[model samples]
Target chain A: MSITEIIIISLIKIVIVLGITLITVAYLVYFERKIAAWAQNRIGPNRVGWQGILQPFADVFKLLLKEDIVPERANRIVHAIAPMIALFVAFTTYAVIPIGPNVNIFGYDISLVVADVNMGVLYVLALTSLGVYAITFAGWSSGSKYSLLGGIRSSAQMISYEISMGFSIGGVLLLAESLRPIDIVNSQTNLWNAIVQPIGFITFVVSAFAETNRLPFDLPEAEPELVGGFHTEYSSMKFAGFFLAEYANMVIASAMIVTLYLGGWHLPFEQSLGLSGIWLTVAQIASFFVKMGAMLFFFIWVRWSIPRFRYDQLMNLGWKVMFPLSLINIIWVAAIIMIFN
Target chain B: MSQTSNSLKKRKKDLTFWQKIYIPEIAKGLALTFKNMVRPKFTMEYPEEKFIPPPSYRGRPVLVLEETGEERCVACGLCSRVCPALAIEVQAAETEREKERYPEKFEINMLRCIFCGLCEEVCPEEAIVMSKDYELAFTNREDAIYGKDKLLTPVSQLEDRIEFLRKYK
Candidate 1:
């Protein structure tokens, strides 16, 4: 492809991805409220615009109009930049996640992903780890006990959980024998990783919850203990950035889970229907999103249903339980591959 | 520790291998929540659909206007004396009626009123009773202190509550 053409294509992809991510994040919050209401036998937001469809917009506008208050003793530069870093990391990680198979678009073959890097998985892991820095910076810079403790808790929780998460991913990596997410998705055409390795899937899902700082693993922002946690001092748009980042990270986690274990865009027994060209690609992408949506629902469902684990219990589970289970999963995968091959 | 020390029989049952796995329990919980998601929502959309409180429901307090368009209050100040929140302010005036007295100025601070139904209970003439106007919103303190203009309701509107009070009280 020519330089300008490549630039144009990249720009288009960036815009499309960012737009979709933002909109999805907004609706995710709405659905979270709705589902929570249903589970608890209460009416959710439905007054603003046709069952609260415009609720998220109203929320954004309200946040924008609010005063951006910074703590008197806060490190102004770092405190301001923390949420931006979090937002940046959350959105950028979506670049390598393949939403669908390649398709011929106006004569040029285009992959659905923004970037098809060879080490896409590694890039994702790296970016997610950098997300910790944002939390830590927010906590430390805020110069408040609550924010500082929240930041400290988040870093500790993430690091411990990430170990188990990485080990669980090892089983999938062993099977695919490639770090490229597209290749991993292609390998799952016959058998999904979740089916072959249930243990790893469970641990990975748990770790993903902790990584996203969701409820049941949401000790960092446990309102009873930490107030608003790391973002306690943040108000207005700065707070919104962290809020957006958290939801966006949930999206990325769901997408990753779908791509890794649920066979990504590949659907079973679609050959009989014989979809061709653009139609086939569209079907593939739709399948991927459906899987992702199911994961997202599960995330929210688990959040509302289960109570958060105690801090000591959380550490014990991460180190004593998940870490070992993931290691065993790797061994089990290795044995299965050897026996079969 | 306290629970464990209380009684041997109160101890948690030793978890079986299957129970220890916890997957089944998690699945059960997930199934329950999923079932709830599809179940009928108990949401009552307010404003659009106001709930008609039953006859026994105690809502805002109002003075009862009789069939003759005259208030039943004797201006004895029993309601004012009984109001725990000091919500009701009654000024008695000499009247030419059979009761010989009436409230010249009757006011109830909606904000101060705790909806305890004490004033209604204390009214000797069955003059003041709770009405079904539960949607009481006031933007200012002045607006909240409802005078006779806001508190007086036609006897017909509170007949059910009146009937209920007569039967039960």
Candidate 2:
């Protein structure tokens, strides 16, 4: 492909991915509310549209019309930039996650992912670490006690959990022998990483929940204790920015979990079925989405069922339990490779 | 201090291997919620389906307008005297009808009315009864002070509440 062609293709891919991520994020909020209501045995929002399908649009309009309040004591520039940083980190991390194998499109070979860098896994970890800065900055810049405390809690929680998260990925890296996401997905063709190393799977998932600031680890945004937490002083579309970023991060987390552990787009015993070409590619892509959707549902399910962990309990779980378990997982994976290879 | 530490250890030891892990307990909770998710919801879907309160429900106090277009109230001032919140105000005036006195002006300040049904209970003529009109909203204090026109309901409409009051009171 020529320079211009490559540029055009990359631009098209970026638009498609961004559009999909945004729409999914919007509906994810709607589903979160609906599922929460269902858990409590009450009919959720059905007034906006049929079964409240248009509830997200209504929410967006409501947020857009609200007054954007900034505290007199706030650090204006940093407060303004915090949610932007959050949104940037959430969207950019989606670039390395491959949805399907390379397909010949109009006689040009095209990979499904936007960018297929060799160190994609490292890139993801680095970007997600940067996400903590967004919350911390928002908390500190808000000039409110609640926001500051939330920021402090978020940074501590994320930093602690990221250790176990990294070690859990270490087990996958040891097995795949490549930091590239596509290579990792390709490695788990027969037996998924989840089946081979259950301990790593469990730890990685728990860490993912903590990393995304979902419930059970949502101590930073604990309403009763910290009010609105890091976003306490935020209002209008700026607050919506944080809201969008949180859900977008969830999409990325579930996608990462699917790619690393559940064998990405590959289906078990697919070769024995003797499928070929476009049909096979389509099936594989569908499988990828199905797995990702199941993971998303599981995220929502666990949220409504489990209560938030106490701060001391959270720290203990991260350090005393999760960190050691992830290390043990790495050793276990190494033993498996030694026996098999 | 030793006893406290010992009790803590015993509490820690009480949890079996599975309970300590928490995965199974979490799963059990998840299953319970999932079952509830599929079960019938209890939402009333107000506006589409209005709730018909039983006769005993004390909603909003209203004056009964008899079929002959005269109010059942003879302006005896009993309800106004018994009102704990001082919500009811009635001024008696001479009338040519056999029920010689009528309220020239009767007003109930809904803002002050606690829905305690004291006015209804103290009515000598069964004049004021609580009706099933609970949807009361007003933008200003003046609008909240319901006059005679807003407070009056046809006697046919208030039969359920009046019947309940007769049987129980």
Candidate 3:
């Protein structure tokens, strides 16, 4: 394909992925509430449009109408840029994810991704780590002691969890023998990596929760302590941006889980389906979505079922538990591979 | 008998590597929460459904009356003197030549009443009692002020008083 045509195709994929991400983030909030209510034996938002499906939209409208207030002593530029950076980094991580195989679109074979970079896994890791910058900047720029403390806590929490997160991926790299996302899925043709590296999977899942700053690891945004945390001073669209970034990160984490462990875009028995043409691609895409949905549900399930961890407890669990477990898991995988190969 | 637990406490040491990870404990916590999720809820839908008041509940105050439509209160002024909230007021008047005291005006400011049933307890002739009529919301201050007729109970429930008055007369 010509360079111009490739660029156009990439643009289309970017638009589509962003659109999907936005819609999913909106509905994910609703899904979280419904699941939480069901867990707590209470009726959640059912007033808005047919079982509260439009409640998120109503919330968005309310947020938009609210006054955009920037504190007098706040660093104006940094305050404005923090949430945007967070949101941008979150949206960019989805570029490497393959929703489906190449398909004929208007007489051109168009790939179902924005970019198929060889170092997709490292790219995702790097972008996720950058998320801390947004929170840190937001806290520092707000000129408030509470925001600063929250930012510091968030950084500490994220850095500690990130070590395990990176180490957990080492197992996937060992099994797949490649850092490429598509290659990882291709390696799991016979068996999913989740079954083989169950411990690593668990570590990854826990680390993902911490990385996203979700409960029970959501101490940075603990309402009673830090109010609204780093974004406490934010208002209007700026505040909405932080919320969007959080849900978007959740979506990205779920997508990564599907890609790394559950075998992205690969059905259980692809050969048996035997249906050629676009049908296989369609089935693969559907399978990818199903895995992503299941992971998202698990995220919401854990959030509602558990209480937020205390700061000391959270730090202890990350450093004293998850870190050591991840290390052992990596060493075990390496030893097994050495013994077999 | 208490010394039995000291042995277990002394034996409890640092957690093993596996236990420190808390995978099993986390699983247990998850199980507990999941169990709670399925259990019956404790929520109460108000407005649409009213709660059944207990037998000991002290609701609104009402004055008893005879079947002949005579007031059981004899304008005694005892309920007024004993009321802690000073909610009761009575002005006595002479009836005919008998010098029998009857209230020219009687009122009970419900907003001021503490619902302690103190007046009911202090009534010598059981002339005033609390009834199960608690839906007494009022929009205006004046509306909450209960007059003699409104505070009086129905004659049907004062059958004994009606018969006693007939026999005594």
Candidate 4:
């Protein structure tokens, strides 16, 4: 494809992906509420639309109409930039995720992915690490002691977990023998890495929770104590940006899980399913979504079922426990691979 | 010997750097939490699933009547006088033919009633008592101010007591 053609295709893909992500994020909130209500034997949002499915849209409308307030003493530039950075980094990670294989579009062959980089895993890791900057900036720029403390705590928590996260991915990289996500899936032709690298899988799952600031590890934004945490000063679209980033991060994390461990888009024993055309690509995209939805549900389940951890306990878990276990897992995996080879 | 003993006391068994790392403990904690997340939640579904109130629970106040269709209260005004919260108000009227005292009007401001059950305890003839109607919610102030007719129990339930009172007299 020519430069212009590639640019046009990329823009189109971006628009489609972003539109779907925004809509999905809205529904994910509604889904979370419904699941929570079901678990608690209460009626969740049912008045807005059919079974309250439109409730998240209604919420978005309300948030958009609400006043955007900036504190007088706050650093306005950083305050505005923080959530955008978070949201941008989150959305950017989706570029390399292969929803499906190649297909013929208007007599031209096109891949479903936006960018198929050799360092897809590293790119995702980089984007996820950058997500902390937004939180930290929001906290420090707010000029409030609470926001500052929250930012510091969030950065510390994320950094601690990131180490273990890197180690977990190291195991997957070793098993796959390639840093490219597509290659990783291709490597898992016989069985998913999840079966072989159970310990690494556990580490990755737990680290993902901490990295995204989900419940149990969601102490940085603990409402009762921090009073809105790092984004306490943000309002209107800026606040919504942070909200979008959170849900988007959740989506990205789910995608990573599907890609890394669940054998991304590779259905087992499907050598003759005739999924080579557009239909195959569509099915792959659908499978990716199903896997993501399951992971997202698991995220919500953990959130509603458990209480937030204390800051000390969270730090203890990340540094003292998860870090060492990941290291041990790495060693174990290396030993096994060596012995088998 | 003294120096050796001091050294021994000072050389406390500090956790090895590896033990201090806490990876296994966190794994255990994660397992426990994950197990809890999958476990069945204990939830109480309200409305359709009602909770059984305790036996001694005091609810709304109701008035009692005699079998001869006479109000059980003889207008002694004891319930009104003894009520610490002064929630109950009673007025007496002399019957034209019998020249006997009967309550002309009875009103209980539930808004003011502290639900101490003092009025029911103080009723000399057991004429007033609290009933098991705790689902008492009102949209208006007027609705909350329960008067004589609304405060009284159904006539069918009071009929037996009223008949017994008439037979004894």
Measured over the true interface residues after superposition, the C-alpha RMSD of each candidate is 1.1, 0.5, 1.9, 5.2
Question: Which one wins by DockQ: 2 or 4?
Answer: 2
Q: What is the lDDT of residue A270 in candidate 4?
A: 57
**Reference contact recovery of candidate 4:** 0.03
Instruction: Write down the TM-score of model 2's second chain.
Output: 0.89
lDDT tens readout by residue for model 2, A1-341:
99999999999999999999999999999999999999999999899989899999999999999999999999999999999999999999999999999999999999999999999999999999999999999999999999999999999999999999999999999999999999999999999999999999999999999999999999889999999899999999999999999999999999999999999999989899799999999999999988998999999999999999999999999999999999999999999999989
Q: What DockQ results do all the predictions give, each relative to the true complex? A: 0.71, 0.82, 0.39, 0.12
Question: What tens-digit string does per-residue lDDT give for candidate 3 at A22-52?
Answer: 9999999888887787788876787799989
Task: Put the candidates in DockQ order, highest first.
Answer: 2, 1, 3, 4
lDDT of 2 by residue, B55-160 (tens): 9998989999999898988998998999989998999999777889999999999999999998888888999999998999999889999999998889999998
Fnat for each predicted structure, in order:
0.68, 0.85, 0.47, 0.03
Q: How many backbone overlaps does candidate 2 show?
A: 0
Whole-model Cα lDDT of every candidate shown, in order: 0.92, 0.95, 0.85, 0.82
Candidate with better DockQ, 1 vs 4: 1
Model 3: how far residue A224 lies from native, Å: 3.2
Candidate 4 residue A339 Cα shift, in angstroms, is 5.5
Q: How does residue B49 of candidate 2 score in lDDT? A: 94
Off by over 4 Å in 4: A1-8, A38-43, A65-73, A175-178, A232-238, A272-283, A304-307, A328-341, B1-57, B65-71, B97-99, B135-143, B157-169
TM-score of candidate 2 to 2 decimals: 0.95
DockQ of predicted model 1: 0.71
Docking class of 3: acceptable
Pairs clashing within candidate 2: none
Best by TM-score: 2
Model 1 over residues B105-166: C-alpha lDDT tens digits?
99999889999999999888999999888888888899999988888888989999999999
